[model samples]
Target: MFFKIFIFLLFFIQSSYAHELRPAIANLNIYEEDNITNATLSIRLNLEAIIAEVDINHSNTKESKQSDKYESLRNMSAVELLEKFNSKIKNLQNKIYLISTNSNYNLVLLNIDIPGVGNTNVARDTIVDFDIQNIKDEDLKFFWDKNLGSIILRVNSPNNEDLYSKLIATGKKSDWFNPKNKKEVDFFDNIRSYTHLGFKHIIPKGLDHILFVLALFLLTPKIKPLLLQVSIFTLAHTITLFLGVLNLIKIPSVIVEPIIALSICFIAIENLFTENIKKTRPYIIFIFGLLHGLGFAGILNEIGISDGLFISSLISFNVGVELGQISVIFLSYVFIALLFQKRLWYRNKVTRPLSLIIASIGLYWFIQRLFF
Candidate 1:
């Protein structure tokens, strides 16, 4: 019966990947010369998601649903996809809105290049080059329509050699990007933005991190033990996260990802045979936290942190992540520990069972990530 139940849970967890959320990335490069402004925006996103967002009939379909037409689009060669986009360039342009302080300028479709075939596992980039009259004197803001997934925007200003990046959600407009605007973000505002980034990473997005933290939570029934472990974990990760962002310490995802999965399995499995936190557990957690911190840095590096705002952004993001971690701990206490910690059967029925499930998932992830 135990084996049957475990199998069922494993299968259920495997099926959950179909509903996973993926964010789109848009890299916008704009430069002005000779009174003309040229812009090249390269957007990388899942073709099926974009199709579901744009197609009238399929717009209402859930992104997880498999579509034959969408698969065909995904299989198309770069030239073929470019041709199709060229034919419907106007419609595509309308989906992304750009406005200057004084007037809205149209983005003329110059060219499109879809990635070459052979990496179906990865999202493809659609390069769109266009030009508009130089709006150096005015503020410019841009946004995409609703139903498009989260967007990471990178803006390059040639005038001052400043690079600005921000995460913009669907239907949300970006901050005004102007070459002449030399103003640095206020400390409080920097804290607010980066803190949100850090929090969002953990709450809705950081499933792996959540599992790791949960593993730590199940290690002992007492709050003191858990708090000590969490504090050490936080400190360890903070150090590596800052080092990783500064490029002083670097580890590739290929190595770090699988090790992280294994760490989750290790902690959760150890909980089955141990009732109290071991003296060595804190050290182990600290090491795992270091790995997790590198993971966090990878995320920030992807969306980017401006050179000028680096220190403030890093500190704010770390604080937000700590808040997120605390929230997770609080939720675990309310939902699990408070209700079951005192029960005679808690160890056998609650902690062991849940730890086994978590360990199984972690082991599966380890195999999948390392081999596949």
Candidate 2:
């Protein structure tokens, strides 16, 4: 009824545990000494996440076969973790890609900061510093392999003033910035970039979000009802996505994720029971959308949008999300629902069975996200 990859990811979640994959945040600062320019890159990351080699595409760490090794590293003392990191030093640097217009600069580890094994309950935030020289004064470009996951790169001036920041998408090389000249990205380009980000999130990346949208469609096969629900869900999430990113209404992912799973469970279960659209369904969905928006915010927050691009970025991202949800509905209707919705047994045979599977998946996610 749903995507095969969705089914695959469901099994992934089933075997996985509590750790979620988070982006590594890196800040690059430029320093000038006697007319020469050098830069220091400080990255705050979950070293264990990289050391244990979690699958980059999946959202949860437990999805990886090496998750056991990841957990073991997570439980290690600061010194122990450093030893693990040292073992992978050469291979790890090969994973990082940084270049200028003229040449590739090597990343030399200056030092590192690792926390003492404090809360084995949470992923430890390890910060590492590296030095890269700039002799030719060429603009710098950054690239991240999927294996390294996503990166939130911020550029700073020697005076400590913010120069530029971006959530560099995977495998995509960033615009050449710094080295006394930052690349100018026009408004339309920003829209395209953010929109792609939003679409990517819903289509392949956001399994939980995809389930919610599909559940909405299974409830009412008609275009009108589905559109109404989708529109309301879109608007509600847009409001909270902006608010969540701006830090006006911040809700931790820990609380938001479980509730999001619960919302999907509610919708899928409702599909199994209700024949006609409920008047109150939209209202309930509106509230759920708000919570989902907060979950959406976690991505942008990690990415760190610039003040100037905040409005454009948020609107573009929401538009992309809408496009993504619409794509799901459109494909389902064209392929599956269209041929079957008119049948007398459609609701009983198609809708109920699919809804049951979806409901079960949601329930599992809820319990896993909550207490696991």
Candidate 3:
């Protein structure tokens, strides 16, 4: 019965193609010259995704309804698409909200550029530039349109030549900033933001990490064994996460992702043969955790940690990841181990069966990532 259920889930998960939760990037350049505060905002995003978000008639339009038209837009030259995008400038402007200490500033569309023709399988970058005037040098708050996916805001001050960056969701504004002086983000605020980033990565977005943790849980029902493994895994990943972020060690995602998937498969396969935790299991987990840490660092590298608060950001994010991992283990204990650990059929029906399903998915990912 479990084997049949597993087969169905494997096929279902593989078939579903949901929109990826990739982050869009926005670069904000703020500088003051001749008693004038000038701001230029350049936003890069997936063109099709933005169109789908803002176009009210998109569902009924050919771009959304017809695959061929969508492909044409995707493959259109950067200049060609920029011309088409000109019509939607107002809609895009309405989505980006900016406010200064003295007054709210309107973003005027300056220009738009698409990098190149993109395809359905690959996302293309569409860059939109905006001009802002009538701004004071005081604290400024900025936000992107909520309809857009997650956005990573990079704020740069040409006057001082300093860089500050943060990730913000739709409708959420960023931290206040002054371009003239070194902006110091509060320690607690830094912790709060990065912690949320870490937790979100694990709970909703970190499917691969979730599966890896689950594979460890299936190895035993006892808390002692689980805690020992979890502690070792956490320590191992923390070491490499910091190392990778500092650029002391660099491993390309092409290699790291496949290896991470293989680690999941290895653990799940081992569970099928070993009922008790193996003496070498912790050592194996420690190694796998090192790879997983690099994965975590990859995310930080993308969003960027503020230079002023690098250590705080790193520690807070790691703390959130640990919290996320613990939550996974606790939930598994309640829903799986505590509920059926002593059942006569638990080993054959639950543990072994679930392990096989996880193993299958991991192996599938391994092959897909490695060869395809």
Candidate 4:
């Protein structure tokens, strides 16, 4: 019966997150100096998606002979357009921040610090990087979001003028390049930016992390054990995140990503079969957390961090991640405990199908990560 249910869920989840070719490109580049840093970022927003969303929202206006697509877009609300652009930016930022935090860097935002901007209608490049002196091994992994077609980090030598030139050249190659007033960006003022990035990293975009926590909750559903498990998972992942980012312990994404996917599957399957939450679950989660941490580190390796403040960056990033995880747990209990815990109909009809479905999706991710 369980197997049948699991198989059905496999079908359901595959249909839900079917991989679509993304419409945007994002990349991160890092270069270190004794105490100064430079990071060049490129994000090409999916103009199609943006336009589609706008068209859908404001379709009541009558068709006119003067309707030029570009002009129409320009006429759209600045608030609405900025909101959409910011939403996409925030998601990319969250993912990048998570990767950076895992990689052991506290990425502070110096300013808007973009290279160029002329008109508001056209998509503009948003470039930001920091200068630091204390480089740590934990701050070297590269992170990219395959789903979103966004690149997070590309690190280069601190004083390598050639590398810097290459980054600029590549930006030019993209037809949408808009070079504007060059402005100096201060790295220290980015504390607030770092905090915002960290908060979003854990809360909204950390779906995989949230799912991991949920799997734990469904299995234990008790206070003491749940707290212990959360702590262990957090500690274990943080330790390995530092190690992996620092390059002391290196694991290929070919190995790490698939296993991370498998961890999700394992937790979900266990929820169905295991009655007693083992005292050793924390230890096991710690081991798997280590793997996930490596995966997280890979993300930061892609985004450049200033070498001067590497340790503090690491601490701050990890702290943000911990806070994000805790928020997930609190919210899950608040919503799920109230909605489903008291209802047997959900426990059986809904929970069974839902878990099986989610697990199947996890299984699919496992295979894709391993084989493809």
> All models: lDDT?
0.75, 0.82, 0.79, 0.53
Model 1, span 247-346: residue lDDT tens: 9999999999899899989999999999988888888999999999999999887777877888989999998899899999999999999999999998
Best-performing candidate as measured by TM-score? 1
Residue 175 Cα positional deviation in candidate 4, in Å, after optimal superposition: 24
Clashes of each: 0, 0, 0, 32
Instruction: Write the residue-wise lDDT of candidate 2 on 1-372 in tens digits.
Output: 455645865676454423666678888888897888888888998899888887877777776788789889989998998998998878877777778767888899999899987655457899989888754566778876777887888887788766677777666677778656544557788898789888878876677898899899999888788889998998899899989988999777889999999998999999988977799999999999999999888887777766667799888988888889888888889987879988998988788878877888899888877886
Across residues 293-350, which tens digit of lDDT does each residue of candidate 3 receive? 9999998887788888899999999999998998899999999998999999888888
lDDT of 4 by residue, 120-203 (tens): 323333343433334443333334343333332223343432121111111122111111211222345334434444555556
Q: RMSD of model 3, in Å?
A: 4.4
lDDT, model 1, position 131: 56
The whole-model C-alpha lDDT of candidate 1 against the native structure comes to 0.75
Predictions ranked by TM-score, top down? 1, 3, 2, 4
The residue pairs in collision within model 1 are none
Error of 2 at 239 (Å): 1.0
lDDT of 4: 0.53
